[model samples]
Target: MDDDLHPDGAQDGREPRSGGANLLVFLALLPLDALVGGHAWLVVGMNGWAAAHNGEEATVPVTELVVSGGVPAAAGLALCWGRYWGAAVAQFALTAVLMAWLLSFQG
Candidate 1:
């Protein structure tokens, strides 16, 4: 056993390196963060379009923004952290909010 690599006397077969773990965590979060950030931008763009079309009024994109941004963001975060349950919950909440928005808008 490499004593230098196992300064803390960890019994694992492979020794741990702080740098390697940090790199792995960063790589894992990279994809998730990108996806969520991209979706956030999309939500913003869509809101802009809707607002512009609605005679420049300060319309809140509660539905579009929340569902589109929140679902993907939550899912991405959950995936990065290996939390399937959180992802599922986020999906359900987003769906419900979207449905409510749709029904309310159907006036």
Candidate 2:
């Protein structure tokens, strides 16, 4: 077996470090999701209404709803399934940017 695959020297046969790291990423993002407030729900509602109306006169594309809701979800999933560190970094960066943007209005 490759040594690099088991950086923590797992001779006792245990799951890789990435799994725990991914779980941590998932856990960390949960609060960020909450901090996002009701925007996700609002996006869903808008998309649903627009779909029912055949998107006629819709101000935003349905894809916007998916993106608005998917970013955090995808980040979590990515951490679990793909690059754990990358996902964590991306999630933290996004959260910081969002929080900064929200706080910017407080003068």
Candidate 3:
């Protein structure tokens, strides 16, 4: 006669999980992150294109995009299987960072 709404805590039961759920969450986010990361990485490609086309260096924006996109995603992947709160916070921060990066690209 269990009464807990989840029976497994809020998400990861606040204890050691079997890693499946975290893996699933990671898989779910992988595509989205890859899409965004790929777009961000394209800044490098754009730099090459622009450099070849206009003979100018575009260093700062490319580096900024790579750092902003890659680091948080790597952090998110690293923390996805830690704890419930860890996962939640990582996901939230990841989303926020992604959104902020996306917004930054808007003209």
lDDT (CA) per prediction? 0.52, 0.56, 0.59
Clashing pairs in 2: none
**Model 2 residue-pair collision total:** 0
Q: Residues 28-57, candidate 3, lDDT per residue (tens digit)? A: 766766676676657655766787688765
**Cα-based RMSD of candidate 2:** 11.5
Worst 10 residues of 2 by lDDT: 98-107
Q: For every model shown, what is its TM-score relative to the native structure?
A: 0.40, 0.36, 0.49
- Against the true structure, candidate 3 reaches a TM-score of 0.49
Q: Tell me which of candidates 1 and 2 scores higher on TM-score.
A: 1
Model 3 global lDDT (CA atoms, 0 to 1): 0.59
Ranking, lDDT, top scorer first: 3, 2, 1
User: Backbone clashes in each candidate structure, one number apiece?
Assistant: 0, 0, 0
Model 3, clash count? 0
